[model samples]
Target: MAKKQGLNKKLILLDLVFYAILPYIVWNYGKEPFGDYATMLISTIPGFIYTCYRFILEKQFNIAGLFIIGSLALGTMVNLLSGSAEQMIWNGVYLGLFYIVIYFIALIVKRPFSLYFAVDFAYLQGYARKDSATLFFQKGIFNWFQLIQVVFIVRGLFMAGLTVFLLNKYGIDGYGGMLLYKQIAGWFFWMLITGMFIYINIPVQRFLAGQQDKLQDKKTPLSTDEIF
Candidate 1:
C-alpha cells in the first residue's frame, strides 16, 4: 500500500509537470514538428493517454485521481482551444474561474477539495480512511480543511487573472515571453499554496486523529500544548 501510494504521488507530480509545461514545449521544441494547434494536440493527448495508462496499471485509482484526471482533461481543453498567444494567455484564466465555481460549491457543501487532496498525499505516508485504522476528519477538523481549499481557490484565481491582465496590458504577443511569465508566476503561486497547506492541514489532521481515537475509545484524546 505504501508503494502504491508513493507511486500515485510520483504519477501525479509527473502529470502536473508534463501537462503544465507542455504548452511551452509546444511553443518552442515542438514548433517545428507542426504548427501551434497541432503541437498542442500532440503534446496534451499523450499526457491524457499516460494518465489512462497509469489507471490501467494500478487497476484502481487513489482518491486524488478524480481531480488529477479532471485537471488533465481541463488542461487538454484549454490547450486545444488556445491556438493564439491571446487564447493561450487567457484560456487559463477561464479554467481558473471555472474551478472557483466548483471549489465554491465544495465549500458550500462542507467538503473542500483540498481536504481530499491532503488526505490523498498523507496516504503516501501511511494515512488511511478506514474507520478501523487512521480516522477521517470530523466536523471541526473538516472545517479547517475547507479553509485550505478556500485559500487555494482564492490564490489560484488571483494569480491566473493577474497573469492574463499583465500579458494583455503589455501586449506579450510571443509564446516565449508568455510561457516564461507563466512558469515564474506559477512557481510563485505554488509556493504560497504549499506553505498555506502545511499551516492549515497538519494541525487539523492531528486533531482529527486524536478526536477519532477518543471517540472510538482507542487511545483517548490527550492534550498537547504545542498544537498549532
Candidate 2:
C-alpha cells in the first residue's frame, strides 16, 4: 500500500510538472518558432521517456512501446499537417479510443484489462498464498480492471470531445486565451472526475479488501517459493 501510494505521489508530481509548470514556461517563453507546441512537446518528452524507461524496467515492452511510437507518429503528423495546437488534441482522442478498443479486446479474450492492478492487489492480499492469488488474478482482478478501464475511457472520450468543441468554438488564434481556457478546464474536469471516482470507490474497495482478508484467513500459510 505504501509503495503504491508512493508511486501515485510520484505520478501526481510528474503530472504537475508536466501539465502545469512546463506548459506555463512554454506559453511564456516559446511563442516564436514552434510556439506553445514546441514547449508542450519538450515538456511531455521527459515524461514520455520516463514512461518508456519504467516499462522497460517492468519488462512490458508491447503496450507502452507501441503507445510511445503511436503518439510520436500522431504528434508529428498533426504538427506537420495542421501546424496548430488544436491538432494535438487528437492525441487525447486517440488514447481514449485505444483504451476503449483494448477494453473490448479484453472482453473478447475473457481476460480483465486491469491485470496489473489485480496483480498488485494479489500481492497485497498476501504473498504466501500463490495459488489463491493466481486464482483471483484469473477470475476477478481482470474484471475489476476492465471496469476501471471502461470508466477511464468514458471520461477520456467526454474530455476529448469537450476539448474539440472548446477549441473550435474559441479559435486557437487567441493563443494565450485558448491555453488558459484549456489548462483551467482540463484541470477542473480531471479533478472532478478523479474526486468522484475516489469517493465512489472507497466503500467498494473496503468491501473487497474485507472479503480478501476473510479469504486469506482461511488459506494455509506457505513459503514464498511455494506461493510463487
Candidate 3:
C-alpha cells in the first residue's frame, strides 16, 4: 500500500509539473532560445511526449492521453499560425473548448467525462480496480456524477472564458510586463480545480469509508479492494 501510494504521488507530481508548471516555466523563459513561436512549441513538447510515453508504458490508452495528444496537435497548429502573442495562446483556448465539448457530450450520454478522468488518475492509469472504479462511478455513490456534471460544464466554460479574457487583455507577452498577475491567475485556476475536486469527491470517499467500516464490522471476508 505504501509503495503504491508513493508511486501515485510521484505520478501526480510528474503530471503536475509537466502539465502546468513546466510549460509555465518554459513559456516564461523560452524566448531566449529563439522567439515566442518557438517557445510555444518547446513548452508543449515535453509534456506531450511524457504523457504519451506514460500511456504507452502502462499500455492503457485513456482520456488523459488523448487530451495530451490533442493538445500537442493544437499547440503545433498554434505555433505554425502564431503571428502574435494572442495566437500563441489560442491553442490552450482550443483545448478548453475541446473539454467543454467533451464534458457536455458525456452529460448527453449520461456518463460525465469528469468521472472517467478522475478515476483514471486515481489509479494512475493502471488496470487495478479499473472496472470496479467504472462500476462504482456509474453506480456513483452520493450521485456524485449527477451532482458534478453541471459544475464541470460551467467551470470549464468559466475557466476558458477567464483565460481568454486574460490573454486578450494581457497578451501572451503580457507575461513580460504582468507576470505576477498571470501567475496569480494560474494559481487561481489550480485552486479552483483543487476546491472542486474536494467538494465533489469528499462525499464519495466518506461513503466508501463507511461501507468499508460496515464490511469490517460484519466480519465479511471481502475487502475494499474487492469492492473497489
Candidate 4:
C-alpha cells in the first residue's frame, strides 16, 4: 500500500496567508498606488500563483484538483474582463451563485459531490475506490454523505449573501474589509462543517473497522482444517 499523505499544516498556513492575509494587505496598501481595479487585480496574483504552485507540487490531477484549477482560471478571467472593482466583486458573487446551483442539482440527482470527495480521500489513503464507494453507500452512511452536500450548499448561500451585503454596504473602498470578514466567516463555517464531519465519521470508522474484522475472520482457517 502507498503511504497516505495526510493534510499538510504548512501548506494550509501558506494558503491562509496567500488567499486571505496577503490579498487583504495588498488591497489596503496597494490601493493608493495601483487604484481600485488595478489593486484588485494585483491582489489576486499571490493567491493565483500559490494555488498553481500547490497544484503542481501536489501533482493534483484528480477531480478535486481540476475543480480548484478551473475555478481559479475562471476567477482570473472574471477579474480581467471586469470593467470596475464593483463589477469584479459582483462577478464573483455570480460565480458563487452558479456553484450553489450546481450543488443543488447534484443533491436533487442523489449524487452528492461530498461522497466522491470522501472516495477520493479514501483512495489517497490506500483504499480501493470500488470498496470505499460500496461501504459509503451502506444504509446508515449514505444519508450523512448527503448531509455533507447540504452543508456545502448552506456555506455557499451564506457566503453569497455575505458578499452581496458587504459589497452593497462598503462599495469599492470596502474590499479590504470584505476580504477580512469573508475569511473570518469562511473559517467559521469551515470549522463548523468540519466538526460535524468528525462527529459523523466516528461511526463510519467503527463500521469500517467492524467490516475489516469480519473479513479477517473469514480469511482465518478453522482448527479442524488441520485434521482434514
Candidate 5:
C-alpha cells in the first residue's frame, strides 16, 4: 500500500508538471501547430492519457476514475465550443467538482473516505504500543475527515473560480501574468490547507487515542475479572 501510495504521488507530481509546462509551451509556440486552439488541444491530450493510465494502475474503478474521465471530457468540450482561455479554466473547475462529489458520496455512504487514512494511522499507533488495535470507526477520525473534505471542497472551488477569472481577464497570450498568479496562489493555498490538516487532524487523533489509553489503563485486570 505504501509503495502504491508512493507511485501515486509521483504520478500526481508528474501530472502537475505536465499541465503547468504544456500550457506555456503551447501558448508560446502555437503558430506552428495550426494555431492556439489546436495546440492547446494537442498539448492537453498527453495529460489526459497519462491520467487514464494512472487510474488503471491504481485500480480505482470508482468515482476517482469517473472524476478524471469527466474532467477530461468537460475540458475537451469546453475547448471545442469556446476555443478560449476559459477552457483551461474549466479544467480546474471540473476537477474541483469531481472531488467535491466524491467527498459527498463517501459521506452519504457512511464510509467516510478518511477511513483510509484513519486505518493507516491506527495501525501505526497500535504498532507503537499506543493502543491495542486499530479502530477506524472512531468518531474523532470521522469528524476530522469530514472537516478535511470540507476544506478541500472550498479550496477546490476557490482555485477553479480563480483560474477562470484569470483566464477570462488575460487570455492565453498572458502566460507570464497567468503563471505568476498561479504560482503565488498555488503555494499560498497549499500551505494554508497543509496547516489546517496538521492543526485540526493531529490534535483530534491524539485526543481520541489518549481517551482510549485512559480507558484501557482503568480497566480491571483479566485475573481480577471473570470471563463471560
Candidate 6:
C-alpha cells in the first residue's frame, strides 16, 4: 500500500513566508527604490522560485502539479511582459476570469474538476482511479463533489471582485496591501473547503473500508472440514 501523505506544516510555513510575506515585503519596500513596475516584477520572483522548488521537492509530475506549474509560468510571463504595475494587476484579474470560465464549462458538462482532483488524491492514497471514481460517484456523495465545483467558481469570483475593489480604491500603490488581503482571504476559503471535504470523506472512507473487508472475507477459502 502506498503511504498516504498528510499536510506538511513546515512547507506550509515556508509557503506563507515565500508566497505572502516575502512578496508583500518586496512590493512595499522595493517600490520606492525600484519604482512600481520593477518592484511588482521583482515581487513575483520569490513566489515563483518557491513554487518551482516545492514542485521539484515533492516530485509532483501529476496533473495537479502540472496545473500549478502552468499557472505559475503564465503569471510569471504576464508580469515580465506587462509594461506597468496596473497592467500586471489587471492581467491577474483576467486570468482569474479565465479560470472562472473553465470552472463554469466543467459544471455545464457535468464533469466537475473537483471530482477529478478528489479521484487523483485517492489514487495517491492507494486507491485505483476507477475504484475511486466509482465510489465518488455514488449518489449520496456525488452531490458534494458538484458543490465543491461551485465553491471553486465562487472563490474565483470573490477574489476577482475583491481585486477590482482594491485596484479602484488604491490603484498601484496598494499592491502590497492587496497581496496581504488576498492571502488572508485565500486562507479563509481554503480552510472552509478543506473542512467540507473532510466532513464528507470520513464516512465514505469507512464505508469503502467495510466493503473491502467483505471482499477479503469472500475470497478467503475455508479448510475442507470447516467448509463441510
**Candidate 2 residue lDDT tens string, 1-228:** 999889867866766665566655665566666665665555456455665666566554334345555666665565455444556555555655776677667656756434443344345556434553454454334455455556555655666676677667765544445445555666666666455435534545665788899999999789899978
Q: Candidate 1's residue-wise lDDT over 102-204, tens digit each?
A: 8889888877777676666666566564541233356655666777778778777877777766766766435545555665676667766677666765766
Clashing pairs in 6: none
- In candidate 2, which residue ranges exceed 4 Å CA deviation? 1-11, 36-39, 49-84, 120-133, 137-143, 173-228
> Which lDDT tens digits does candidate 5 get at residues 116-169?
544444454444312412343567655666666666666667776777787778
The C-alpha stretches of model 1 lying farther than 4 A from their native spots are 1-26, 29-36, 39-62, 81-85, 132-136, 170-172, 200-228
Query: By TM-score, how accurate is candidate 5?
Result: 0.59
**lDDT value for model 6:** 0.84
> What is the Cα root-mean-square deviation between model 6 and the actual structure?
4.2
Clashing pairs in 1: none
The residue ranges of model 3 lying beyond 4 angstroms of the native Cα positions read 1-9, 12-17, 20-25, 62-68, 115-142, 176-228
Query: lDDT of each structure?
Result: 0.66, 0.57, 0.66, 0.84, 0.62, 0.84
After superposition, the stretches of candidate 4 with alpha carbons farther than 4 Å from their true spots are 1-12, 209-228
TM-score of each: 0.63, 0.55, 0.59, 0.84, 0.59, 0.83
For model 2, the run of ten residues with the poorest summed lDDT: 113-122
* Residue lDDT tens for model 4, 96-187: 99999999998999888777777777787888989988888887788887898898999999999999999889788888888878877877
How far off is residue 69 in model 1, in Å? 1.2
Candidate 6: list runs displaced more than 4 Å: 1-9, 206-228
> lDDT order of candidates, best first?
6, 4, 3, 1, 5, 2
Question: How well is each residue in 1-228 modelled by candidate 3, as lDDT tens digits?
Answer: 999779867876777677667777888788777677777667677777886788688754467567566765766676677765566566667767887787788888877655666666666745455663654464545266655666767766876776777677877676443333444555566656556666766666776788899988899577789989
RMSD of 5: 6.5
Q: Hey, what RMSD does candidate 2 come out at?
A: 8.3
TM-score, cand. 1 = 0.63
